[model samples]
Target: MTDIKTPKTWRSPAVDIYETEAGLTLIAELPGVERDALDLAFDRGTLTLEGRSDDIGYQRRFRIPEHLDAEEIAAELKDGLLTVTLPRAAGARARKIEVTVH
Candidate 1:
């Protein structure tokens, strides 16, 4: 009988999100994922993250709110932890209005 190879199974990473004055922040636990092996993308109000290591892999997706600015999104990977910051669009952020006497 010939030997057959089974495909590798991937797992989802642990993630956490937080609400801030400017917008939202996402934190993902990527134990074995290297910075160069990680992929992040935001499009059409959706956020996608994927990563892989020699032995394991991870993937996850999130629906971003319309108010968030996808163009200015940023992320960082450090010590096996990934931090993503989604800043609110200029029009969506809270601002102070000045009242003038007529």
Candidate 2:
């Protein structure tokens, strides 16, 4: 008799997104996932997160807008919680300008 093994399934982590005047904040719950096992990437205006632990796998993806500065994106992981901050591009920030008559 031959034994068959099944491939592990990826689970989507719980995510929360909030919009502020300066930028967007994303929080994800990735229990049991360690920093060394986590992979974060930004490509073609899309943000991807992947992680794996001994018992579970976590994955999430979000489409990033052009107004957000991908180069300035930052992420932090602690206590099984991951926080990603996407700051708005300089051209995207709202600024007030005084109008002058010629």
Candidate 3:
């Protein structure tokens, strides 16, 4: 008997979304994925992540809030984990209010 391998279908990776005063952060677990095989996109208010590997393939999408800065989003991948950070827009960040005593 000979060993045979079948093609795998795309799957949804495990993800965690966090929101704070600084902004929103998305963390995804994608083992055995290469840096060049990963694809990320942010258009309008949606963010997409896709990766293909010999054994696994996954893709996921997220809707970003309007108050966040879409253009300056940052992404980093290490140890099979992907971290994406979306910083809040300048106007959307919380600011201290000053009171004038007359």
Candidate 4:
């Protein structure tokens, strides 16, 4: 497991996190945040989001789940909402096995 440390600029925001069969989804209300101003980064099993909305600064850190494939993560900003999708790691993906008995 990677040790995740929140940055000093991190701020708790009103957001919702949900997990689905495909991946993990994060929805954050970032009113007045422009697409170009928002930044998303993932490193060492830590996901960070930072941006400036109307001169107000905001930062947040999320502990990336062990099952999540940080390299495949994607984020989008639209209608003042930031949506992040994190795909599961290879070892974490569901697999099927068959057994034969004689």
Q: Which stretches of candidate 2 lie over 4 Å from their true place?
A: 1-7, 99-102
**RMSD in order of candidates:** 5.6, 5.6, 5.5, 6.8
Query: Quick one: best TM-score, which candidate?
Result: 3
lDDT tens digits, residue span 1-102, model 1: 112222176888999999988999999999867777888988787899988776677889999999999898999999999999999999999989999998
Every model's TM-score = 0.85, 0.86, 0.89, 0.80
In lDDT terms, which candidate is top?
Answer: 2
Model 4: per-residue Cα lDDT over 35-92, one tens digit each: 7777788888788887765546577888987888877888888988899998888888
lDDT of 2 by residue, 1-102 (tens): 112222187799999999998999999999877788888999998899988876577888899999999999999999999999999999999999999999
Show the lowest summed lDDT stretch of 10 residues, model 2: 1-10
What is the per-residue lDDT of model 3 for residues 1-102, given as tens digits with 9 covering 90 to 100? 112233287889999999999999999998977788888999878999988767668799998989999888999999889999999999999999999999
Local accuracy by lDDT, each model:
0.86, 0.88, 0.87, 0.78
Comparing candidate 1 with candidate 4, which one achieves the higher lDDT?
Answer: 1
How far in Å is the alpha carbon of 61 misplaced in model 1?
0.3
Ten residues in a row with the worst lDDT in model 4? 1-10
Between 1 and 2, whose lDDT is larger? 2
Ranking by TM-score: 3, 2, 1, 4
